[model samples]
Target chain A: MAAISVELFAYPWDILEATPERFLDHCVALGVTRAHVTVSYHSGKFLLPRNRSVRVYFPEPGALYFQPDAAAWAGGLAQPVSRLAGSGWLERLARGAAERSIELSAWAVFFHNSALGAAYPDLAVQNAFGDVYPFALCPSHEAVRDHAAALCRSVAALGIFSGVDLETIGYLGYFHGHHHEVTAIPLGMAEKFLLSLCFCPACRAACGSAGVDAESLAAAVRGLLDRRMQSDDASGGQDEEAEHVATLLVACPALAALIRLRMETVTALVKRLSVEAGSAKLAAFTSSFVGSPSNIWMEGVSPTDVGELVECFHLLAYAPDVAQVNSELVFFLALTSDPARVNLTLNLGLPLTTSFSQAAAKVEYALRQGVRRFSFFNYGFLGEARLRWIGDLARIARGDSR
Target chain B: MTELRAGVIGHGYTGKLHASAWLANPHAALTAVADSDASRLAGLPAGVRGYSAYEQLLADDLDAVSICLPTHLHAEATLEALARGKHVLLEKPIADNLRDARRMLMAAKAKGLTFYVGMTHRFYPELREAKAQIDAGAIGEIVAANDCVLEHLGFLNVPQWYLEKKFAGGGAALTSGVHLVDRLRWFLGDDVRAVAGRAGNSYFGADVEDSGQMFLYFRSGLSAQITFAFMREEHPLVCDLQVIGTRGSLTVHTWQSYELWNNSGRQRKVFYTQEPHPAKVQAGIAGEVEEFRASIVEGRTPWPSAEESTRAVQAILAYYESAATGRLIEIGDLHAV
Candidate 1:
């Protein structure tokens, strides 16, 4: 089975911009095979800060963040932003990393966009209730899907990257972590899910083609969420919500059809994107969601058939407690329909979500499950004291104490 | 001035709703009504007369008429009423097609009749105060506005005509989005220069779109995002409108109330809430009918004059055109006198 042996997430700005030789030397000493460099990052405004020392691995060429595209709406042919300003960083780093036999990968972030979504609202995700969540672009729309594919092709076309780590491809829920996001009204988990449901005509037509009455399904969800919103019962008990949702799903066939179709929508997107990415390994970034096995695959989670196109499923095991990691790991092990394609991505530090010991233990656990790869969350985020943990993680994964 | 006799020309659900508003208008007497649907016509009051053809109602002592028929027939009825020297209060869009809307407008102009398009949203008590506040520069300089009015078709009992391309014009946008478009135009008091919209009949599976996202660009450098759908059921109808200004942002959320919050989390506010639900159809129709009657009485155009209504229709039609062509369509192409 194809697998990523060992990888380290890096930022193009941090890893290869100032000192390419020193970065590669660190990689060589740590025994890492690849550098998953962030090719794109989001901001509150359009266009990256101009005249940076390097190009900063910006949006694919002329894809100026949210530049009005005629193809943002569905139909005819999608016009992708084919412009790329040359920084020569990818080429330079790839050449330098090749000297040490280390591969370069574009760690691409798709869908999440504040600038484009703000300037061009047509491309954002709208809920069933018509609230446009400017933080994201609905993958069901051909505009966003095409843009994402074009982004991958652009990065892959550079020929510097051996692989691409696809992150945030699925639906994002209530907590978008926006600045000063005070949702004054209380929204239950199900209410948020209902709000996230996209009944956009393109999505509906897809469901219609699948013989599901998308209209009734949307109505059922709307009705459920409306009842929840009106009823002052603020019981946020996790298990009860799950049971209630299960009961609601069983009661409403249309809602179930919609749920099934949402899964299909996400899978179809990955397949299309994976196909668009020519000559590059496409690894999907799964969330740190801890749940009973089936929950792992919800909200555009890859179904079993996705393995046919995707190279690897990168599961983000970003839990702090070792016990929580082990619990989810067991479920993930039993839950994975395809074991050969799964790899564990442990977070070293981000808002201190996970400790070094926990990350190491999770890596050990994944290795025990016959996994051959380990990709760290990132480099440059950790301070000097915490950053030393990367050396230990690499050495431990590589089976070298020194 | 003998209670300028008024008649409702369509007895469908909307036509019936218009009838109640007409009756509630003390200045206008509900003298007669017309509908091809005999059963719907049979539900009229005892003193109220009924006619199989709306033309026959225009032939009566009617001083004014409400064109609430199938959208395809709205123009015919409106032109007929205007030609017969009767003032007219037309339901949305003027007509299903541009040619018909133009004819009706010209007829109303030639007759010098009060031509009022039923933009009931403008009459919402909270919306009125909100508009006053914005006009009074309560939120300071305008930055951008994001408004949405999403509802569900499953609960709609939507008539067949609503799905018919010939009768309904487009779909949900034509039927419902005009309210939001009209409101935005009124709020900003600026003409829409261009539009970029992405719309589709995603869920309802009809010729008319049930969902859409519209970007309205104003000539004054102001912008607004409008999302309208007929696709929500359990959740309350989404009427979340946020107006961001340089000083602060005013948000009227979930049909309950409006508040102003600064870019910083500090200085939050809570405006007093208005009840009876903003989505309730009966909430503001009485005020709309009164506006129509007063316009007739005062011999002037309505607050949102017929031309303004034309602009709203033109902008939304451009939205559909934009969605269709995948181009930012100019609202000028469709805007006509």
Candidate 2:
């Protein structure tokens, strides 16, 4: 097994509230040499049980934690900032990390901004039925692409981060974990893929440019989704998801070309953003709340296409045991040839890793598969005991006695 | 005058209540009961007829029928009974969706047959008393209200259809919280202008949600918040509501007790403990059934009209729409859909 290095994922508010010294001390105790702090994020109501301050935190919508290059994003579709940036909390944390010889990286979310989308409705992802999903910016829009690139460039300009973990860089679907999601109608994989397909003006234009019939495809998708919703039968089981998607693509061959166009659009954006983050490493999450890596296509993410551009792929193996983690790694490895460029990001707390042994086992299995780096999800959201499990995982990875 | 003959289409929990109410109402006689399950139809009263299919029961002699089938079947059953020239008392939530609800209402209107919704909670004595007081300005001008129901309708407690989304339309919100929404609408005598809601199936992880929360904004400057769940296994069923007005506040709990507080330093409380006598508990449904008969006998509209029930359904659907969109949904937009 390769030597293991674990990085802690945290938020800037958590550092300021816990104080840099205390936060870094906890990181060091867990053998964590690096930390990924959220630089740009979307709106959410979080539960921080271990925090010294408020138990619940509602962050500013689409907030940029660090100071952004004001001149860079002039006349942009999205304008969002966190009040904490004025307090210099991120810079203070960065300075603290520099003094302690701990590496800090910016965890930036790019397109999933409800505030920005709401402000510019035309820029958001519009479904085939012409309903705007204000939470997800349509990547086909050049302005949205520019906004994402500017976000990355601004984070890199801070000069306090080693890398930026780009989240939601591609297209988002109808179910992007908004405040109160009422999806009473259980959607099959094919139906969800159909819903996630963007029919925005830019997307349609892109499809037209790619020589694919966009109008008919959108109408077909709409008809299929409506019929499926109205049907009395429940959604098919997970095992039939792939078969269903295959059947759909076969029936609507135009959908295949459209999907490929979307993948190309995502790849082009990642390629552009990587160039913008000149000095900082460009890493992307392989999965989201949409599904596992197997269902990345729902987000217009093709790992094989993206793997060639980004420095690393953070395989979100947020599973309950080593077996699930193994399946995820197998699927991701098949897409990306170099396992060395892959890092395993696991939840260090309950519902995923219930015991120290389970955490150690996942790390060990990933190590055997040639994944050397592991990033433990969430510093403040995790309790003290889970933090200790991280230290044990690091020791086991390094073949240490402790 | 000859008594109105009534038959119950579904023999579920609410169906049984409708059956008992028909039998209890002197103006209405329980004629027949129909259920897909023969077991549910086995123990009917000596004089009452039993049919395996509701179509058979609707064909029999009856003045009105309480359509207590699953939410998805409410429109089909009601429309069929209406075609047979029988006055219909459809259950709460006129239908699962607006289109079907509108269809049922139109069918009844075209046929000139009396149609009413069984928003049974409106007839609960405590709620009725609270409504009377609110009407008499006991609570003054209403400002805000909150309703909560944490029931125990887990997988083992309910039939499979209750947990299925297609059949039940929704879980706790549509099935249980509909009553709360309708009652609040009735108390305020106002229409919900907009709604925002959140629902989850984290507990049972079934096709339907076991929990829901909603915020309703009325056009009359009134606001209400309703939270309900059917996930608690050990927790006893609790259904309560609190209405706050300019002069005072009124609270009703499970139709068992009520309390009123006025700004003038006067507080009045009424409590009915000791497992409310079965007759008293059944009185709400009996009153609902009686009202159904009275509407037909006098050729007047029912207490809770079909339009009122359709609006209640619209509010509930708006809750779902708000939850789905993660934004406040205007009730008018639901009508457009």
Candidate with top TM-score is: 2
lDDT per residue as tens, model 1, A98-169: 767888877776776665567657767667776777777667777777777767766666667778777767
Local error of candidate 2 at A14, Å? 0.9
Summing lDDT over every window of 10 consecutive residues in candidate 1 chain A, give the lowest-scoring window. A46-55
Docking quality band of candidate 2, CAPRI definitions: incorrect
Q: What is the lDDT of residue A146 in candidate 2?
A: 85
Q: Which stretches of candidate 2 lie over 4 Å from their true place?
A: A1-3, A235-240, B1-337
For residues B1-337, could you state the per-residue lDDT of candidate 1 as single tens digits?
A: 8487889898765676677778777678898999986745654666789999888888999888888877777777787788898888888876656677777777878878888888887876667777776777777888899989876444212356777788888888888888888888988889999999998877767887888899999999899999888763323356777787777777765345567665444333333222113113544666777888888888777888888887888888888889999999876644344
Report the lDDT tens digits of candidate 2 across residue range A1-402.
444667889887777655454577678778888899898888888777554335568888987876677876553455667776765567556655776678888898888888898898898999999999998899999989888878888877778888888899888986465666676677766777788889999999999999899999999999998887877666442434767887887777799899889989999989888888888888888665656665676688778888888877888888786787888898888889888778888887667777777878888887888888888888877766576678888787777897
Whole-structure CA lDDT of model 1: 0.68
lDDT score, candidate 1, position A77: 20
Which regions of candidate 1 deviate over 4 angstroms?
A1-4, A44-85, A237-240, A288-296, A337-339, A350-354, B1-337
TM-score of each: 0.48, 0.54
| Shift in Å, residue A245, candidate 1 | 3.6
